[model samples]
Target: MSKVEITTQNNTKKITLSGHFTAMDHDQFRAILDDLQSGEGCTACAVDLEHLEFIDSGGLGMLLLLRDACIKQKLALSLTNAKGDVLRILDIAKFDQLFKVVG
Candidate 1:
């Protein structure tokens, strides 16, 4: 399972993911989406994957759910600092096309 840490600053919500991300993380992820939805007037949401060690398809789905939530909230969504296995998985999955990716 993954650990999610969320913080907001300068109208941006940053979500940091660590450990392995998979279906098991769904319970925690819901709170994340709720947070995003409730961030009124937020300009962006950034998902930081720098410390994430691994991700499964279920994790990818959760990201997609986050994307949709961002869209409805008019928040720009970005995936940042992905590297190693996490980066490769995202690239192979074409996440770059779905979200703004930054290092």
Candidate 2:
């Protein structure tokens, strides 16, 4: 199961995710991405995966999709507080260089 919570402050959006990020959660993830894309004048967006327990390849793909969208829109997209396997996956994917990875 996955849970995504979006909060906005100071023109920035924070997406906090927990549990597993898998095919089962794609709908929720896509909905959130659509919302972010539709939001007006957002300066930055942060995806917090501190509480995320597991993520599959599809989840990684979703992250890349969001990153590309944000880049095209000139919005800052950041991944924060990733650790353990999640961090390793991002590193292996070389997404560390493509997206901002914050502790």
Candidate 3:
């Protein structure tokens, strides 16, 4: 299971992902995308994975989808605060080449 929260400030949207992220979270994550698409004035998005404990390939795919959406919207996308297993997974996937990652 996973927990997701979204908040926006100063024209940036912050997406917080915690616990486990797998294919099962697809629907939940889609809803998040819908919310983002319907809103306006967001110039950037930061995905916060500080509390995320695990992420599977599906989770990585989801991030890619989000990145695509951000690009279409001309919004900057960044992955932030990833650590432990989550950070390791991102590294293995070479996501740093895809998004700006901040420690």
Best by lDDT: 1
lDDT of 2 by residue, 4-91 (tens): 8998888888999898888787888888888887768779999999999888888888888888888877789899999998888888
How do the residues 5-99 of candidate 1 rate in per-residue lDDT, one tens digit apiece?
Answer: 99998999999999999999998999999888789768999999989999999999999999999999999999999999999999999998999
| Candidate 1 colliding pairs, count | 0
**Candidate 1 CA-lDDT value:** 0.94
Q: Rate the local accuracy (lDDT) of all candidates.
A: 0.94, 0.87, 0.93
lDDT of 3: 0.93
Off-target runs (Cα >4 Å) in candidate 2 are none
Candidate 2: worst-modelled 10 consecutive residues by lDDT: 33-42
Write the residue-wise lDDT of candidate 3 on 1-103 in tens digits: 7999999989999999999999999999999888888659989999999999999999999999999889888899999999998999999999999999999
Clashing pairs in 3: none
The TM-score between candidate 1 and the true structure equals 0.97
Could you list the CA RMSD of all candidates, in the order they appear? 0.7, 1.2, 0.7
Which sections of candidate 1 miss by over 4 Å?
none
For candidate 2, the per-residue lDDT at 95 reads: 86
